[model samples]
Target: MDNDTLLMVVAQLGGGSWVWRRSGGPGSSFVRHQALGSGHLRRPHAVASARLGGHLYLGVADSSKGGTSTVFRWGSGGFYPHQTLRAWQRDTHLEFLELGGRPALVLCSAARRPLVYRWSGGGFAPHTDIPHVPDVYAAKHFRLRGSVFLCLTRFLGDAKVMRWEGSMFREVQQVPARGSMVFQPLLLAGHRYVLLGNDFAPSRVFRLGAGGRLEPAQELPAPTPRAFVPLAVGHRHFLVATSFKGATQIYAHVTEDIGT
Candidate 1:
């Protein structure tokens, strides 16, 4: 809510990998915080999402033979305590969810079968299992009118939409998402919008409507034609973080509300 145009640089330090996030503010060039995570032998274990209970969950695609996952949960004194889950060590994929007034996260295999995990009195526990679909490439969550929705794209180049019915994620009926357009599967803007990037076509904003979907909410204006840049979103603002051509420039997602 400050300068509205802040550039952030990310780096890995001393076996520490962090996402140094910055935003511009008054009298100050930037406001920044580093979301740090533990390092693995080959790749650093990083948290992908955090819950309202103050839990920071780390998600990684465990493709390596010895790959593992570590998720941090908020404990006493506002610090995230690490809780390592060995079940996801092989091919676990992670996504955050807030369904039915409870903060949760979605876990799946590289095969793309989905499972819902909600924070309980004891760390995080399994809530539900989504239908099995192999080789799923991307998954995202969104909400409308207090209902939770989930959308995922498959490796076969298609998108799947599901809605939480106070119990589990069920396939949406009578909706049309090709499952082809969802490419990168990254959640942006505080975990409410789905960003299309990587192999995702149209590389734009996909909002969850009555159900989980990828309908365009906004089309980002590019200063120049480019590709292969990292993207992130915050609430109504979408950031196109790209180091293409060797410079980091961030863009904001806006509709008519930007200049206001």
Candidate 2:
């Protein structure tokens, strides 16, 4: 979202669309600007938006059984359909990242291998696939100790962490997980940490170790955890965890301790 515009994408059960709103300032009310989509969009699952070279790019995923996903570009007067990409049974997440100064899009699915597409001046093109990443529900990219890493969360098996090895991403570590869906990265007291959420197991926190590995730090009480985020109020910091089948929890920051 920019200072003058707010972009939002909606996933309709049958058809999906993207909307843009414009506001006068920080506290002003926003008015609808425009909406765009294609008739082929069905069960849209995720939308990733990015701005490059003064233009906006949007990647939308459709999870319908045989529906194809599409990328929209801002042109002429509004967003126009750009590229249509094939997705699997369920496209769960879409992430936008810049690797080696090139814009890229990462798509995650539950039945097909995770795909990465690079922006090729004219349009986005298939770049590579994350091998063995079936059942992937989410993907996150973070930098640790001057190195970039990609973490893929699976809903049936172990979550894998891959490091960008100059040319491509290579698997570096795996964290035991079951029904995992999200990986939330946070920084606390000069240290990096990752919170793993599983749909059928207890949530966990992993700390960056000496050799770039992640070590178990703490276990959360979340049953069927789904999402996590770091929050701050006044001078106190807190960690919030949301569960799909249990109560939401808030953890306070207690020097050297990851709140209970």
Candidate 3:
């Protein structure tokens, strides 16, 4: 892509290769680009792409027990290997964030604590780790009321919400969950809400209530829900829910005024 077109890259779990497709347009087709991967890569789990310093950086998670995950940089020719994170087991997610005017990367693993790496002009270096965060399946960073917060979804324990306290993130609230996998925060009708998806229980939508707390709003009917994503079309908002064992569902936002 020439920075004007959107591209989607998918990392395969069994083949360890990445397939990329350009967004279809007037003359452009949805043709897949050349697969990217080395022979050493195995069990690719997730990939995250970001633009830093005017360059495209791609972070890929290879979940093999003793394999290394890699970050690739886009250059004139193509994407080239830039950095390597070694000795991670079952790495599941990769996310890039800009914190305090510095580029940072968050890597999550199933068997180890999540780590933060900051860009240091030359390469990404280890910055910090989220304490007591094990079995972390996903992490999302959001801003609320001038404060930045991180939400961690655990597969075996309660999901946690941590707020940035000038230096580091401290736990502010815990949401009881079992087999929690997705915690997506969104704004609907000028209200802050979070969609919680679990594998063992019904998914629920929680809204920010008084005292900065989250209160349950509605429960989804889908079992083993995996992801909840918000989509906006023109001026309307909608939610899409995907489940592991059920059909995908889309819900449109509606409102009604009650007489006082």
Candidate 4:
């Protein structure tokens, strides 16, 4: 690791957000660094971290009525509030990605279409909007064959797969995902897969199939899963899933050689 300090920001729905830092190497416990927006933050939904110009920045999104999201920039002393973004009271996710080789942020909301903001040397500025999509719970980006794609999870309707063209993103695929909350795309064992988590149904996994289309592959018992993270140790692969109403599950990836 280039830096010895690891920073994590936690967002709360009722309380404010907090920044925790861990110094030194492995097994170092994290310590609370600072608390922010104690009386102002309400129903914070998500927190995102990014590195720009060798500096770390953290953003928190809130979904309560009249709530606003805030971005903090790290300084020599500590992290301080750098910018405030409008959350529209229904923002559900904050995603940091690279768009056109520049740092960008996407704010997904249930109230309206998702908005894209690009870093403008000093702060993030509105760049575009993902039109005609509403009630989105989360947005995740993945790269395939030198192209970037976005998977959007909808709370009411079908989930969508969007491809980024020169200037904007266009819908290319849709999966029936009513009541879905998370659509996480990950690369595992040289293959690409997407996990769709639903509140009313079993979570489904889709693999990248022929012609770059997503094909249904398997199902998991994690209902109302919020996130999926892929991990590898030695020659084994694992997947960690967090559920909203159940215990967190860890799954092993085993390849079965079925004779043709």
- Candidate 2 matches the true fold with a TM-score of 0.86
Model 4 TM-score is: 0.93
Full ranking by lDDT: 4, 3, 2, 1
Could you give candidate 2's per-residue lDDT for residues 1-260 as a string of tens digits?
Answer: 34456555555675336464545656676564556675757778777788866778887877878777788888765777888886545787888888887888888887788888888987778888888668788888887667777888887889888887766778888888877888767776456888898776668889877645789988887777777778888888888888777789888877756689
lDDT value for model 1? 0.50
Q: What 10-residue stretch in candidate 2 is worst by lDDT?
A: 1-10
Q: List the residue pairs that clash in candidate 1.
A: 3-24, 111-135, 158-179, 158-180, 159-179, 189-233, 189-234, 238-253
lDDT of 1 by residue, 1-260 (tens): 12244434232324544443344354554434544444541343223655454343444433335655556543332224365544433443567667766777776556436667787755667776777555554466656667666766554544566778888877773222332434333444444555444332334555644445456765543322232233554334545545323354466544456674
The C-alpha stretches of model 4 lying farther than 4 A from their native spots are 38-40, 210-212
Relative to the true structure, candidate 3 has a C-alpha RMSD (angstroms) of 2.1
lDDT of 1 at 43: 43
Better of 1 and 3 by lDDT: 3
TM-score pick, better of 1 and 3: 3
> On TM-score, who's better, 3 or 4?
4
Model number with the top lDDT: 4
Ten-residue segment with the worst summed lDDT in candidate 3?
Answer: 14-23
Please provide TM-scores, in order, for all candidate models, with all chains considered together. Answer: 0.58, 0.86, 0.91, 0.93
In the range 181-224, model 3's lDDT, one tens digit per residue, is: 88877776666888888877778889876535678899887667
State the displacement of the C-alpha of residue 129, model 4, in Å, after optimal TM-score superposition: 0.8
- By TM-score, the candidates rank as 4, 3, 2, 1
Judge candidate 2 against the unseen true structure and give its global Cα lDDT, from 0 to 1. 0.77
**C-alpha positional error of residue 171 in candidate 1 after TM-score superposition, expressed in Å:** 1.6
Predicted model with the maximum TM-score: 4
lDDT of 4 by residue, 1-260 (tens): 23767777787765567877885568988888888666657888888889898888888777877787778888864777788887555777889999889998989876878888999999999889998788788899887877778999997899999888868889989999987889889988777899999889889999986545799999999857999999999999999999888999999998899999
